[model samples]
Target: MTVSSSTECVIVKYEGRIATVMLNRPAVLNALDEATLKELLYKLKEVAGSAVDVVVLCGNGRGFSAGGDIKSMLSSSDESKFLPIMNTISELVVTLYTMPKLVISAIHGPTAGLGLSLALAADYVIADTSSVIAMNFIGIALIPDGGGHFFLQNRVGTTAAKQIIWEGKRMTADEALKAGVVDEVVAQDFPKAVREKAEAWLQKPIKAMVQTKQILCEGNKQSLLQVLELEKEGQFRMRATADHKEGIAAFLEKRIPVFQGK
Candidate 1:
């Protein structure tokens, strides 16, 4: 049996015990705007409440999500517009991290910034060989958000996480795996690999696995919330910096940014 609950920006499809949630905006590499984020949050909650043992989060088009929408960033010049968006992101990240079901992020193509953060929240991440992963918020003179600080530190330790964030370099799938950013790298038939992995997990004592996840996640949930709060305040301050202005200008102009460190 197949069940689908889809919207303009997010698609939810359930097949037996597996639910697949796909980011649907292909035009801009699925760059998440406020609307898309809200839709995704709704669908995630719906799936969390369902009977699915495994949830596969993926993208519909050529790649997984690129990150937050650049257009939205350009437009949200004030606190009123920006805070709401950040809050939504925080809620969505928390929900995904605390979800009872085993979550897998199947990543392909460019996954950077907030997109990478979201993928890190998953229980396991499977990336295609050609996929590029980055925590490139520094390029925009912005700190990582969406519990990125917590998740990255959890995956790769604090020192390495700080280095990666400061350098803002993109990593190939193998490099990401080496850096402890992703779980598995698929060389061929990426979709088949993800399906087989999911099927294999389904054959296990999934309820016990989920229970263990719940215990650990619940214990650490408060820490993630605290990081999210710090990110919100820090990002707001960064948005007001002169470096941020120059960074956005350089990005739009397709030139190298000269950050003033302001």
Candidate 2:
């Protein structure tokens, strides 16, 4: 696949069997605005049902992602406006979680808030010595969304996941590895190391990987129809929140959000 750039913030590059999804906004530390999310979603859909053997998700500039674009959120805070943005985020996370292909995240630098959910959805998460992972939702007076509440609890147990979100503590790469959130901690030249690992995964039959992923994901599955209803209910509830307004507003203003949790 010949990878092309829809814009500077996103680039899709394919070499041999590995498709690389790079977050290109290094200047802003790859902070994800609405456009970035849209581009990413479009790119992901582009690769859907393709013959790509493996997918590598990484950031271009300083880190993987600094989380959602605060400026973008704060500027669009009416519940009506905010709900769609949140919907987009929710869909992205769910898509990544259930993706048929092997998704690997090469995380370096800061991955915060919604970005953390993105990292957690990947099949394998590899971080460098300098990487940082944080929930940081409480820092802005918001509860964890974007499936962080569900994914983190599943990975690290409910009690610990609650503590992490409540405290909004940012974990270093080593700390994340110790907590089992990340699969491996590499040395300084971590990107290359992660690429090597991704390349290796590409050599195997994708069906085997997909089957293993299905089993792991299925272990906790409820009736499929029930789960879909649950997700719809969540969307309905979040749409009624005052904090959603604040979150979107503060993001657009590039200022700290004052979430009243109404």
Candidate 3:
């Protein structure tokens, strides 16, 4: 069943116990603009309250997502416009992370910046071999938001997480898997692999699995919340930086950015 119309930025389809939530702005590589983020949050809440046992988060078109909309960022010059966007992202991340059902991120092509954070929120992440993953906010003189700090630290520990964030390097699927950034990497037939994995999960005692997830997530919930708050404030600071202005200018000009320690 179709939960969202084609015109929506996010679309939801249900089949049996599985609900697939797809990011729908293929023209711009599904970049998360304010409307897209809000629609996603609403759809997630709807799915969370439904009878579905599993949620598969994926993107339509060439790539999973390129991250936040750079165009939107350019437009949000003031706190009044920016903070609401960040808050929506925070709420969406929290909802996905705390979802009662099993959540799987089916990643393909470029998944960077805030997109990586959203993918990490899932209980399991399956990446196609073509996928390139990055915590790339540093390149834009910004920091990762959407609980990136908490999730990256949880997956690869603090030291590696900090290094990855600072470098903002892109990693291939195998590299990401080796670094413990992704759960599984599929070289071929990515969609089939995701389906098989989800079906296999369905065969297990899913309720008990969800219970364990709830316990662990609940126990560490405060840490994630704290990180989100820090990211929100830090992002605002970064937005005001000279380096950030240079980064945006360089991006628009399709050139390299020269950042000065300001």
Candidate 4:
């Protein structure tokens, strides 16, 4: 069943087989405060296990995200309070990383710190030209967490990833695309552009798409032989799906397939 979360900090909107998870703290550029982070974790878990064909993770307001609330983090001395938020960040990132549903990070505005982490973790990241992105953890004297190391390394090579982290400079959408961070960079009208991309994914065989996402994500840490075994199992699983049969039939008939994600 399609489910949506209506929490204060995060808005989970489900429609047309897509769950759009928007970070709602626009005033501070959707800063990752404790409450917002907790709500995000809850919503991500809710969608991760749901039957939604795709998830579009975006931020509401001027930018995609600013990562953390720098002021609150700098002033706070309470480990009890701060640590839980950090832990929740870990959970949210992991959920996005391992989820079977296809996730697309629709970015606009300034995405920095762990915000970049979250975006990189997604299966597809599409941003408009207005977006500015950076690792920027060095500014706070902190290392990149939230799977930043893993995701960035996966996209760019280790050398480039290390250079990016060390430089800690913001990059334009074009530069990001060159770095292999932003999958597609459109002009203005990001809302429409992003939705169009998601809707296009909706037209394909979603179950197989999700299974492919799983195989690729796990392939990162797995050996070549192990990945081959995974591919064998995955191929078998996809072959048994009704969508697969429909796909084969459609190809044979030279017609478009109507996939129900079965």
lDDT of the structure predicted as candidate 2: 0.76
Write the residue-wise lDDT of candidate 1 on 44-94 in tens digits. 999999999999999867678889998877776666888888899999999
Query: Is candidate 2 or 4 superior in TM-score?
Result: 2
Q: How far in Å is the alpha carbon of 40 misplaced in model 3?
A: 0.0
- How accurate locally, in lDDT, is each candidate? 0.91, 0.76, 0.93, 0.78
**Cα-lDDT of candidate 4:** 0.78
Winner by TM-score between candidate 4 and candidate 1: 1
Worst 10 residues of 4 by lDDT: 223-232
Checking candidate 4 for backbone clashes, the offending pairs are none
Q: For model 4, how does the per-residue alpha-carbon lDDT over 133-186 read when each residue is reduced to its tens digit?
A: 999865433457666777777789889999998788999999999999889999
Candidate achieving the largest lDDT: 3
After superposition, the stretches of candidate 3 with alpha carbons farther than 4 Å from their true spots are: 1-5
Off by over 4 Å in 2: 1-6, 218-262
Q: Cα lDDT for residue 116, model 1?
A: 89
Descending-lDDT candidate ranking: 3, 1, 4, 2
Q: lDDT, candidate 4, residue 197? A: 92
Residue 116 error, candidate 4, Å: 0.7
What is the Cα root-mean-square deviation between model 2 and the actual structure? 4.1
Candidate 1 residues lying further than 4 Å off, grouped into runs, are 1-7
Per-residue lDDT of 96-168 in model 3, one digit per residue for the tens?
A: 9999999999999999999999999999999999998999999889999999989999999999999999999
